[model samples]
Target: MDRLIYLDNAATTRTAPEVVEAMLPYFSESYGNPSSVYSFAAKNKDAVTGTRETIAKILGADTSEIYFTAGGTESDNWALKAAAEAYASKGKHIITTKIEHHAILHTGAYLEKRGYEVTYLDVDENGVVSPAAVEAAIRPDTILISVMFANNEIGTIEPIREIGQIARAHGVLFHTDAVQAFGQIPIRVDDCCIDMLSASGHKLNGPKGIGFLYIRKGVKIRSFIHGGAQERKRRAGTENVPGIIGLGAAAQRAARSMEERTAKERELRDHLIGRVLAEIPYSRLNGHPTDRLPNNANFSFRFIEGESLLIMLDMKGICASSGSACTSGSLDPSHVLLAIGLPHEIAHGSLRLTLGEETTREDIDYVVDALKEIVARLRDMSPLYEDFVKKNRQ
Candidate 1:
């Protein structure tokens, strides 16, 4: 059997061994509920508290400000919905970018249906939002602004600090979905003036089904979940003790090795992109060259569908994605791709390959070779390619 070359780190990461080790004991002997009064439970509660403190320190946020949630989606939904409800009297208007994760875009749409007005900001060709545009979009009724710290599909890092400053100038609440950027990049919420931030554990090599929301102290946000005293009543239900512990361990590892990991990943990612463009004809890189995630490399091959390319790569034991996996079953191109001015056909041909801690130069080379072959075969079969060639020959 061929070994799988997993490159879809932006979609989700394989849990780290250290993180898995940290979570094991909680699932067995230390399974006591954190809310219980017994000694067994007290130990679990303390662990949870310690994890929270660790996460808080990493983000440079107050310990009291972080609230655990199921994942990035939940955090996004809660932040947008809670902010709208909590500050309804101030305004019912929100601002966000068109290239945001579906978690934020869909939640904003849902709020729109519920009488809130939402302004979808456009991104430049490089998939970057203009802070000036955000400032101009602000209205007296605007109560919140949510933008992702880094684009998941194209991997373009936004000017979050500038946008946060614009939001603050307008006295509007600012929320950023940092699910892809949190552990991968150096993020200090205080330094960035980010009032709210959301992150998922699985994206950072931790267990799935656990994430956190950083709500700056004094930010008005209502409860999204009800019934339990968990998460200081901001989020309900019993704690995901094991997953949280894994997230903490992952965060700690990320904090310590961020610089080293980032440098290595960037080197490999750039090499992959350069090799693919040099080897494959009619292929172009997506997203900003320098302002992209260190681990992300997205590209578009003219004339071939992304899904077809993905399937071909998968058959070659190369694991990659056509943008968001959640939207995979749909035949439509990703919203992120389309928003960046790609035509429907070009957008449909995009591929995202995200590296991680385990990714090696050898793995990248293998995937690049596989991609060059697969794209050539797919393009040869494409009628559009034939037409393009015929026209160019004239």
Candidate 2:
């Protein structure tokens, strides 16, 4: 069997050994409900508190402001819904971009159904939102502005710092879905003037089913989950002690080696992009060339279906994605691609290969060679390619 070259780090990551080691203690010998008042339980509760503090320190937020949740989707949903409800009296208007994750897009749709108005700003050809566009969309009734720190599909990093400043100057709250950007990039919520931020554990080589939302002090957000008094009555349910501990461990590890890891990933990612474009015909790279995530490399191969390409890559032991893992089953082209002005046919052929800390130059070489061969074979069988070639010959 060929060695598996896993390149789909944006979807999720393999849990680090350190994270697993940190979590094991809570799952067995220290298996106690974090909300319990008993001594054994109190120890677990302390661990949860410590984890919150660790996460807060990483994000430059206050310990009391961090609220743990199931994952990024939940955190995003909570931020949009809770803020809309809490500020309904002040205004029912929200602002975001067209390239956001479905977590933010779908949540915005839900708010619209409940009488809230949402303005979705457009992105440029490189899948980048303009800060001026955000400011122009702001209405007097706008209560909150939500934008993703980085796009999961195209890997385009938005102008979040400028957007954050716009929101602050307008006196509207700002929230960012930082699930994809949190571990890959350095984020200081205070420096960016971000009022709220959301992140997930699995995206950062930590255990799944654990994430956190950072709410700046005095931000009016209503209860997300209704039940016990966990998360200081903001979020409900007993805490996942093991998951939290693992997330903290993962966060610490990521912060310590972020600079070195990012530099290496960027080098490999750029090399892959350059090779694929130079080797393949009619291939176009997606997203901003220099401003995108260090680990993400997305491209569209003309005349082939993305699903077919993904299947071929999988058979070659090169795991890649057509787009977001959440939207893989859909027959329609990626919304992110369409928003960036790609035609339907071009959008349908997009492929994403996200790198990780463990990805090596050898793996990149193997995948690049595999992709070139696959694209050539796929194009040979494609009637669209034949027609395109014939038309160009004229």
Q: For model 2, what is the C-alpha lDDT against the true structure?
A: 0.94
Query: What digit string (tens of lDDT, one per residue) describes model 1 on residues 1-394?
Result: 3888899988899999999999999998899999999998999999999999999999998999999999999999999999999999998999999999999989988999999999999999999999999999999999999999999999999999999888887788999999999988899997788999999999989989999999999998999999988999888899999999999999999889999999999999989999999999988998998999999999998999988888888898888999987787999988888888989989989999999888999998888888888888887898989998999999
lDDT (0 to 1) per candidate: 0.92, 0.94
Q: Which residue pairs in candidate 1 collide?
A: none
- For residues 101-183, could you state the per-residue lDDT of candidate 2 as single tens digits? 99999999999999999999899999988999899998889999999999998899988999999999999999999999998
> Which segments of candidate 2 are over 4 A away from where they belong?
none
Candidate 1 C-alpha error for residue 152, in Å: 0.5
> Each model's TM-score?
0.98, 0.99
> Clash totals for all models, in order?
0, 0
**In the order shown, what is each candidate's alpha-carbon RMSD?**
0.9, 0.8
Superposed Cα deviation of residue 137, candidate 1 (Å): 0.6
